[model samples]
Target: MDVSDILASQISKHKSILVEKDVPLDTDVGFLTVTDPSVVDKESYDHDREAYLQSTARDGIQHLLAALFSLPTLPSPEGPLAQLPPPTTQLPRAKPLPKPKPPTKWQRFARAKGISSQRRDKKIWDDERQAWVPRWGWRGKNRDEETQWLHEVPANADADHDPSKEARVARKERTAKNERQRLQNVARAQQGRTTATATGTQVDRKRDINRTLATTRMSTASMGKFDRVLDGEKKLRGVKRKFDPIEKSVDAEKSANLALIKQIGNGAPGGSSLKKVKRDGLDSESGGNGGAGGVVNVRKAVRFASGGQGAAALARKSVVGSGSDGRQKRRGKR
Candidate 1:
């Protein structure tokens, strides 16, 4: 036979048994009493009772399945398997614990009488000090005598005490004086003025001069004309003027250029006139020299040439006109 036919026959058998036993269809079999009058012995009754109870428990589960699956009656043992309710899709949410309320006087009293509410591990008894000390650690207890002395506070110590009125007034005066002095120093520096020393004594100018003379030993033998004059020394004749190396070199060049011009003026080539010689000399002197000194020398040489007005004009023109040539050369390059 097919599987469905077999299942149908088995179910029909179970239904027939249930009907012959005369069991109530709607009663919860698990709670039903044994009403059989033929049962006499207690053992037999108990045996029957246990069997019935087991059967009823099984039937109760089957009935629950039938109801959940929308069946008209209880499922037989051999009936097609029915699905169980999707086991508690989610667990019931737990409620939060209520907040603790503050202790009443009675609670506090109870706690004082050896019923501690707070954790007791924070403090412990210190054997050496004979005191209740913190569990974490103690500070400064094992320190040396010197360290204990340094850490000690005086009996009369008052950190927040105000100063006396007289002390406050004196401090204000001192601060004001310091501020005024600072402002005066700033003003002097801005205006390029020298500040005097704190003692207010006049500086000894003569003393400073005496000190310089002693240290430097400046005397008439090593002095210039200006220095000698300041020192009240008698002026002497034919004492070649003292000049720096640069000035000495410039003087030598000027003398050489003058000699060259004099030679050129005295002996010119056949066709070249005195004016032409003078012009040539000036041009050579100016070209060889540079700076304001060259322009001065050119003018001096021209005046000495005896060419009069024309020579002076030519000297002026040469000095001024050279700038235009330099500018024109720069423009041409661009």
Candidate 2:
């Protein structure tokens, strides 16, 4: 037969063998057909035919051996392999790691032996009772209004009145008194007067003046000599220039005395003329010319007796009546 006829017959035989072995023949398994003579080369066709025959023979032998020995079938890629269990020899079981234990109280104490422990209790030292006291529990700091030591009674203690009770009663009385005083102050304020308690008595006034003088003396004593002199001069100036309504009455009294002195110096009756001058001055406020003239004469006489200068020197010195340089120097020496 020719090459084509021989190849076709061989292909038909292989097809029948595959069918008996239950191997499905698709495109990969070459089958010679009459209409396609150039499908595969001679060398390639021979190699493919050999491989197909070998694979089919191997599969048939394996199946026959399995059936004869009654052995389990080898796993296939799609079926047996997927349902197979994983190899135990490849992956051994792993035991869980052990847990670490916590530190004990003794270990903690050793770690913090040198450091101070944090306090949770509210106990404080009581100086009066000489003991430690809890602030807010039973027998706490606020159990009694008085201190614990103060509340303690002796074995021989008599049934005397309680000092704490007495203090409370006194405090209440003082509060009532203060309330009454406040009402009195309000009433006094409505009447346009200061509170009675605020008003100083004559004795208090005298005491205050004495205190002021004592303080003044003390302050002056503490000053330097030059400062003391300046302070004294300032005080003298203030006294000389200070004017008051009281001073006017004092001046009137002094003038009356001066008039009496003048009358006595002139050998005239003092009381009668003085009375007459005052009566006339009172009767006509604008007609005090006689009394004025008499005062001038008395002033001149007194100035002359004191070795004072004349009207010309008086005018030069102005109202202060400072004398000549010689007298001023003499007074300075004194």
Candidate 3:
């Protein structure tokens, strides 16, 4: 009744699913990849390239699938599904590490002076307040005099001189200076790949700072009219107002303009026409107004020559010479 011989014949007809190698195949079922470290059979590969490649791929796939199936299966709606384990193989990062930020001007100075930075607490202890107050900003310890109700006036102080008012003014000035410095630092940082050791490049930095100062000055309320007057700053000059003759009628004005145009077009006493002279004058006045006939942009040329300071400043600079005193004065003015 036993069919052991028949069963043995059927089993022998099929190839075994198991695969063995010199080096054990590494399987990462999560990634569905198998690392075959064993050397390939050169003789078999050379004999049949396609067959060799197919067989190699087949072995890797079989190893990956076998590892996946070994995992414990959970019940699912359609069928049991085995969960893949986390990948063991380490992969390189797709992106490169970020570069370090360029150091600020203060940082460079600190480095040169061999000064190490120490963390300072934002809050400072006040003996009068009997509580911690901020070092700066929002009822800060720096504004102790300004916020206090009572103040002791000095014997030498003027009757109108209020210590509280003076203190408030001084605090405002201090804050403004700090903000200006911060803006200057930002402008310098924007200049690409600067080294801490360079001295010749400071003029370029000062140029940026001067522009920033001008922009911030206009940014204040009343278009910087009410803001503190900077030292050596030019006084506000009123524009000369002009008006056409009120006695002349519209018809007369049009006729007069036409007559003038006709006179100019008829040419001057010299051989050349007055119209050419007028056109030349206009072109000269246009400066860098993007006129097609403009050979050289006067504004850009002046800016480049004076290192961002206008023609008037350049004239003053030439007159004053390159002495440290004059240079320092120009910097302070900006």
Candidate 4:
């Protein structure tokens, strides 16, 4: 008889397998593809494959039975059929492992939000090395840079008051005016102290007049030619000169149009003014204008191509080149 006829006849003698009939005949035996040798060790599988049929132990016979059950037909007549014993071994029923519990609400929320659990629990930034470093919310060193709005807030005033919002805005405007007065007062106080330190009390009255005259002269020099300076351009003007709106408005409009960005609140975004302040070619390095002493030490570079010997001397001596050597010397001493 042919091998196909012999196999068909033998398979018909046994009961059908436990799986559903609608499952493809090929699919029933396909689970052998997922058998990883690493699970039961390669050596053990190889040993069972090569061992003598008579010497086959309990586990080896069990594996052989499993192979038989998974196959389509009983072993062939000449394929160890006569030597094999009747199938009596059964695999132990495995208890299903318990399912893991779902994560807590906070954990689920953090995962959904795409933030760390620890960060969600804590405030935005943590200070390190004398710098206010932000941990979340924004990526930049200056939080204001990331902000969309720049509300003119009153210095030292509460930002979140509803009833006092108009008053707060007015307060900020008043403060700006007050700053000019405060600057004048400070200049007068400094000049008086300088005179007192260098000369006798007899010249104190005379020194006051001289100081006022000097401040008036400085104020005239500081005022810019502009009628209105843009916020961006205004910030760029430090102690060197007040901003000139006439010179800066065109530049500010150009910057705003470069990027079509939306503001966050009522205020405008991007503080392009702050960015311009950084780019105005001022000496940004340490001790450029203002240092730890809260004093701006301005040193105009003397180009050797020009008649710079006099300028160089003035820099070295810390003297104002206005013929009053005694006052210059006193200013240097302070």
Using lDDT, give the best candidate's number.
3
Cα lDDT of model 4 by residue, 11-128, tens digit: 9999553432232222112322212122334575677765633333333344444565545544676663323333343446598767554454445677999977543333334354
Candidate 1: TM-score?
0.14
Better of 3 and 4 by lDDT: 3
Preferred candidate (TM-score higher): 2 or 4? 2
Clashes counted in candidate 2 amount to 0
For model 2, what is the error of residue 166's alpha carbon versus the real structure, in angstroms, after optimal superposition? 1.0
Q: For candidate 2, report its TM-score.
A: 0.16
lDDT of 2 by residue, 196-311 (tens): 54555646888799777655644665443344454444332122575545546777989978988898675566458888777555544333233344343444543664467644
Best by TM-score: 3
Regions of candidate 1 where Cα sits further than 4 Å from its true position:
1-45, 71-93, 96-334
- Give TM per candidate: 0.14, 0.16, 0.34, 0.14
List per-prediction Cα lDDT, in the order shown. Answer: 0.52, 0.52, 0.78, 0.48
Assess the local accuracy of residue 332 in candidate 4 as a C-alpha lDDT between 0 and 100.
Answer: 36
**lDDT (0-100) at residue 154 of candidate 2?**
59
Model 3 spans > 4 angstroms off = 1-96, 128-131, 194-334
Per-residue accuracy of model 3 over 1-334 as CA lDDT, tens digit each: 8899999999999977788777899887877889898888899899999999999889888877878888999999999989888878778879998977768788899999999999899999999779998998887888888878889899999979899999999989988998998888887776555545444577788979977877777787788889889799975444589987788988999998898788777644454567678767666645434454566555576677678977778767766775445533443343
Clash count per candidate: 0, 0, 0, 1
lDDT preference between candidates 1 and 4, better one = 1
